[model samples]
Target: MSFIYSISANTVSRRVILSKFFKQKRLYSSKRAIILGIETSCDDTGCAVVDTEGNILGEALHSQHLIHLNNGGIIPPIAQDLHRKNIENVVNAAVKLANLSFNDIDAIATTVKPELPSILFKKFESMYI
Candidate 1:
């Protein structure tokens, strides 16, 4: 299994980025690779399952815009808490939408932004590592 971390807001951009990454790394086989992407860099918890052909198998997103708006602005701690609360659900929803389990995924990808709080990594490690 392989792990690739990434951060992007647009679906098209993510595909492009992943394509380049896979190609540059020469990580391909006769079978198209299936990727699970997780994003929690900013105000949303997003997950998606996609194939090497740029097909979007499934996707889920949880936004914190409203909560932050209510709070006047994004607070790091609140954002971290929300990501912790939503990451699993979002990933599961995407996998479910794809009608496949984690066993079917070839690789896992996630956003690793500098501004991200450390607590989010703890949540991810507990779930996936």
Candidate 2:
């Protein structure tokens, strides 16, 4: 089994610099928000950074399809271990691709629910704030 991670809106902060310098409802407000999305529901691990306007700033992904296929299907423990090992690299690549650091991200969003294991869900949950 390959570990899966999902995107969530936890790492972003809503901070709009409302100043008189350039008023009149900016198209993409500073408060528009930037989100880092991570998805790991099955054999693919994906991460993306997007703005509130639905613009993708950066994205990274890793697929374990070949690994699983060679094994004749995913083994839960194997999948979980793979996810654990690859998540950090995936996330780091996303940040680099976005040309931003963790502080620049407004939030982090990951899928957490019936689709993912509770332990994996909790791992992302702790990244909030």
Candidate 3:
């Protein structure tokens, strides 16, 4: 029942930077681990339960993409409010989709970066805590 939990956007951000910096052909490869992932770096409230095998057991996403696009990019407070509004439901759906629980998760990871507003952590707390 042991699995890893990551709040990391590392998959989406830093890895790309490092890959580009080092001129590495391959930045990373997924391993044999189960991960519960959350993303609120912007407008989308996304959650997923995935195994190291690239199998997504469950996933939920609250997309503000269209909204932002229509509104002409992100409005900070609106983004934060949307994330705060949907984070919990999104994560819960992902977990339920995976048919797993927190006790089954091994670790928790988060996406940390600069220039991004506070939506990430705020959504984090809004989700569970």
Candidate 4:
């Protein structure tokens, strides 16, 4: 006499995968956060708006390459001065492109550390206004 044991394999159901996908989508949909990123640590003044889902809504950047090249080098005072003048326009353009107003932004992020000269830091701080 011979006897054989039956074996079975279990497969993941489609509903399980779909349920997980919808759960993830719900988590992402529950809230919206937009970040305005400003980078003024160097000769390039840049601004970007991004959402929590890793989408860039808008961006604007202005480079001081030509100005500094004409001067043969970056003059600290001139770079800081130029940033002061261009930051407003850059931020405004980015906001408009993103189709958002200042009030709609959840937060503003800027490079404010690794302190530069006192005057330069002050100039960067002024952009917050």
Candidate that would win on lDDT: 1
- Per-residue alpha-carbon lDDT of candidate 4 for residues 52-101, written as tens digits (9 for 90 to 100): 79999999998999999999998777877887788888888888899998
Please list the residue runs of candidate 4 whose C-alpha ends up more than 4 Å from where it truly belongs after superposition: 1-29, 114-129
Q: Candidate 3 — worst ten consecutive residues by lDDT sum?
A: 14-23
Model 3 score (lDDT): 0.60
Q: How badly does each model clash, as a count of residue pairs?
A: 0, 26, 10, 0
TM-scores of the models, in the given order? Answer: 0.75, 0.68, 0.62, 0.67
lDDT of each: 0.73, 0.65, 0.60, 0.64
| Ranking of all predicted structures according to TM-score, beginning with the best and ending with the worst | 1, 2, 4, 3
Error of 1 at 31 (Å): 0.7
TM-score of 3: 0.62
Better of 1 and 3 by lDDT: 1
- Highest-scoring model, TM-score: 1
**Model 2 misplaced regions, further than 4 Å:** 1-30, 114-117, 124-129
* lDDT for model 1: 0.73
What candidate 3 gets wrong by more than 4 Å, as runs, is: 1-33, 114-129
RMSD of each: 5.2, 9.0, 8.9, 18.7
Q: Please give the TM-score that candidate 1 achieves against the real structure.
A: 0.75
Output the worst ten-in-a-row residue range by lDDT, candidate 4.
11-20
